[model samples]
Target: MTAALCLFLAAINIATLLAFWWDKDAARAARRRIPERNLLALALFGGTPAAFAARQMFRHKTRKQPFSTYLMVIAAAQAGGALGLALA
Candidate 1:
């Protein structure tokens, strides 16, 4: 990947991770939680690894229904794109 793409991915991943952390804290505080769609959107923006790591680390959304499905789809898409690029 190019330097710019790498940097963008890194930033998005970090942001996704922080968002998960923030949402966890919000839940614990009984505050308004971050929307599930927003988290999934972060994954769509190439934050799959960070989102997965955050889910595992925070013990959040591991068992959720559509959320897990969305993450899986995002991961699959990223892998497929990488494989396509490699074969090209």
Candidate 2:
């Protein structure tokens, strides 16, 4: 179970990173882009680390209003959840 969970998280993070990269590329090409909700959903589903890394690496969605705010909130909630688990 632990290994499976780790594998799932790894896959999701990779997918999230690829999504961010693709979205950035699409933006540069003026093409259809990934939706903000989808990105946030990825982050909410154990892809937060990749989301942050991709944001910094690609310089994507760094200063966007509400998106940044939403990301931060999600990060905080995840952190809190992890802390609670650790404590428990």
For model 1, how does the per-residue alpha-carbon lDDT over 34-60 read when each residue is reduced to its tens digit? 999999999999899999999999998
Poorly placed runs, candidate 1 (over 4 Å): none
lDDT for each candidate structure:
0.95, 0.97
In candidate 2, stretches whose alpha carbon ends up further than 4 angstroms from where it belongs are none
TM-score leader = 2
lDDT of 2 by residue, 1-88 (tens): 3999999999999999999999999999999999999999999999999999999999999999899999999999999998999999
| Candidate number with greatest lDDT | 2
Model 1 reaches what TM-score against the true structure? 0.96
Worst 10 residues of 2 by lDDT: 1-10
